[model samples]
Target: MRNGFAKTDDLIKMFNVSPGTITNMIKQLKTEGLVIHQPYKDVKLTEKGREIAIQAVRRRRIVE
Candidate 1:
């Protein structure tokens, strides 16, 4: 889920979430400038999003 883009279909399969749920989440991420999403295309993270994701991973590792 990092270092590259992911299609909505792939995300759906991975998360087992509804399409509407993924759409809404993508919309929210777009609003936050954290992702670039278009209908029928892959989703990519912005630099800000990537940094945040890395920090989250580090935090999770610390917690574990």
Candidate 2:
């Protein structure tokens, strides 16, 4: 969700991860109801996903 509804290709490029890896991650996130993918569009976060992302940011700040 950090890329503001990023596409698979965009995420792969941004993180330098393999397409297969991204696919698996996306699949898991979707299964967990943390992400939603629209046809021909980027993947967006569900409310739960956003909350988790926000908390992760806060945690990172605290740790840093």
Candidate 3:
């Protein structure tokens, strides 16, 4: 399994958003302490973010 972060460029492509939009979202996430980002580097999920993501997936599965 891949255990590393996705690059900012990869996320921008994945989300089909503009670079500016991604930058804004990253800033928001960082502000919320949900992610850690650096310019020209990968965006990483904080522990809080990871937990929330996992819970969201689990909830989706349960609902499905």
The better candidate by TM-score, 1 or 3, is 1
Deviation in Å, model 3, residue 2 alpha carbon: 4.6
Q: What is the per-residue lDDT of model 1 for residues 4-48, given as tens digits with 9 covering 90 to 100?
A: 999898899998999999999999999999998888889999999
Q: Where is model 1 poorest over a 10-residue stretch in terms of lDDT? A: 1-10
Off by over 4 Å in 3: none
Where does candidate 2 stray beyond 4 Å? 1-3, 38-40
Ranking by lDDT: 1, 3, 2
Tens-place lDDT per residue, model 3, 1-64, is: 1465878888888899999999999999999999988988788899998999899999999999
| CA-only RMSD, every prediction | 1.7, 2.4, 1.7
Measured against the true structure, the TM-scores of the candidates, in listed sequence, are 0.90, 0.85, 0.86
Looking at candidate 2, the ten consecutive residues that score lowest on lDDT are 1-10
Model 1: residues >4 Å from true position, as ranges? 1-3
lDDT of 2 by residue, 6-51 (tens): 8778888988999889888888999999999854568888999999
TM-score of 2: 0.85
Please report the candidate that would top lDDT against the real structure. Answer: 1
If the candidates were sorted by their TM-score against the true structure, best first, what order would they fall in? 1, 3, 2
Worst window of 10 by summed lDDT in candidate 3: 1-10
